[model samples]
Target: MILEEKKKKDEKNEKLQTDLCECYLLLNMWISSELLSICVPCLLKAASKKEESEDTRKEVEMALLALCNLRFIKIEQELYLNEIKEIIQHHQEYHNLTRLAYQSAWRFLVSRLWDDNSLEKVIVVEQHFAREAARELEELSKSVDWKKNKKGGERKEKEEMITTLRWMQTLSFFFGNCYLWNEEYVELFSSIVGVLRASRDNYREISEKCIYPFEEASGRRVVKIGSLWQSGAVDVALEEIHKSAKDDEIAAKILKFFMNVSRRLKEKKKDEIEEMKRKELKRKIFEKMEEEGYEDVVTSFHKTFDFLSNKYFFDDALSLDIFDYLVNV
Candidate 1:
């Protein structure tokens, strides 16, 4: 009886291994309608690391490879897109599993935008990818700290920004065609614009216009911020700033983006008395903030923006030398 049970268990293991092998083969050779019905379920099961063990990592890796290639398959169903989003957003073991999810996302994206042989459809199917790219980049921007780092933390902050910048520059290419498909492409531009304005390096000259989102999102936010100074329009960004404060690094990126925007406008419009004019502008902004239900945050943002924009305005140092004063006297 023991030997019989052992034999049955061996057979079951053999069957699972065979199915996993077949899943890879189907993924590579092309999953037919018949094979897809069988392969996808098995692959998804194998791809999961509920145990998250090193022993099971190989299975997860293979499953991800299968999914990466299978992302080549055209899945038009809304349900499938949501599933992919959940996988990409899954945070349980994101550090280990996200690499595959990210790769699969890229593959899923490029496959749709791949333009080599087929007759073009009137409406492109690029919304899912553009939205995902935008969301991911937005998350990064919100997560990064724009505050003055201490000596030891400066390198870490720069590394984080550079990594996010690289991702934005690469994904912006894939998001280009999404403009015609859906407005999700606009979200991509908004997110990337936030990064570009905050980044120390210039990516525009590198990627060119192929990666540029649009004038309305990039230039407006970095320069003027169309309606951000208004009471009604400030809520969305104020909320983002509040959330950033709750994170590991106390990010000030969203606020910095707006501050820079405000500074640029002030520079362009400074034609009259400096101090009185600056006080009026600051008063108006504070009143708008007070009316916008941001009492807790308003004070902090107000002080930070004031300090950054007027770094030299408080200087009391005189440049006159004693010898020069004697000569003049």
Candidate 2:
């Protein structure tokens, strides 16, 4: 009887489901924090609806993306533990919802980590939240089909693995800086490294989002002992991506990764041994690029008219992602 009732409920709401909103528009437009303050609550209320039906679920998903887009503004308040719990319990509404949870966590945590008082607050709940995320991630990674469509009304569209990995990468940055890096679930880090290493086509995002955040989070030592890039997996992926990628988006991500790494090495201090190692790695990368005939990747990146005008020269419709990269890269 319960199963039938659940099915009927799901069926009734399925048709009311809406498509994911163009949250990217928030990225492409000029908006102020004051204006965002007005819109954020509406999105959150939509995200916080009581029902787990498809329509409500999509609303939550869209709101989360919109929140991530406006991440520049300091979050006015911390989310309740119950709401954070629902983010991990996203499987009840949809599959990719768990990933959206990671993004929300990233956006929320990052806003606070830079400030003294807010960082104090993060330290208080840091271990508890990290452990909860690890447990949920352990369950989610069990059947990670990056290409498969989500269940129910989302069957037509494949899972948004790229965005999900970006979120995880941001989470990794937070974890890298927190006590969790030194003392929490080692297995969870291993799983993330494994999945990221296995990725092929979307490796550009991995390089920019995943590896870069890990670098930012760690101070003296970049990645921990079992860190993904330390395993040489990131280098291998970059070689493959540089060799085969033709799309402008992929090129942009790759170029941005290279740009960022060069800048980090130049500005940061490191121990003698790690310094030698990084220089050697950089030399090898350039050598390989020359061999593969992608020596002109950056030159080509600069030459791309749309990106040049939109991002570099005009900087009008610039994205936050690109802004962050250019500042650090």
Kindly list the per-residue Cα lDDT of model 1 for residues 219-290, writing each as its tens digit. Answer: 332222333333122334444445433221122333333434344445433556754555565556556555
Residue-wise C-alpha lDDT for candidate 2, range 89-174, written one tens digit per residue: 55344554545544564455454554324453343344344454555555554555544434465333224454446456556546
Q: Which candidate number maximizes lDDT?
A: 2
What TM-score should be assigned to candidate 1? 0.36
**Distance (Å) between predicted and true CA of 290, model 1?**
39
TM-score of each: 0.36, 0.48
Q: All candidates' lDDT scores?
A: 0.43, 0.46
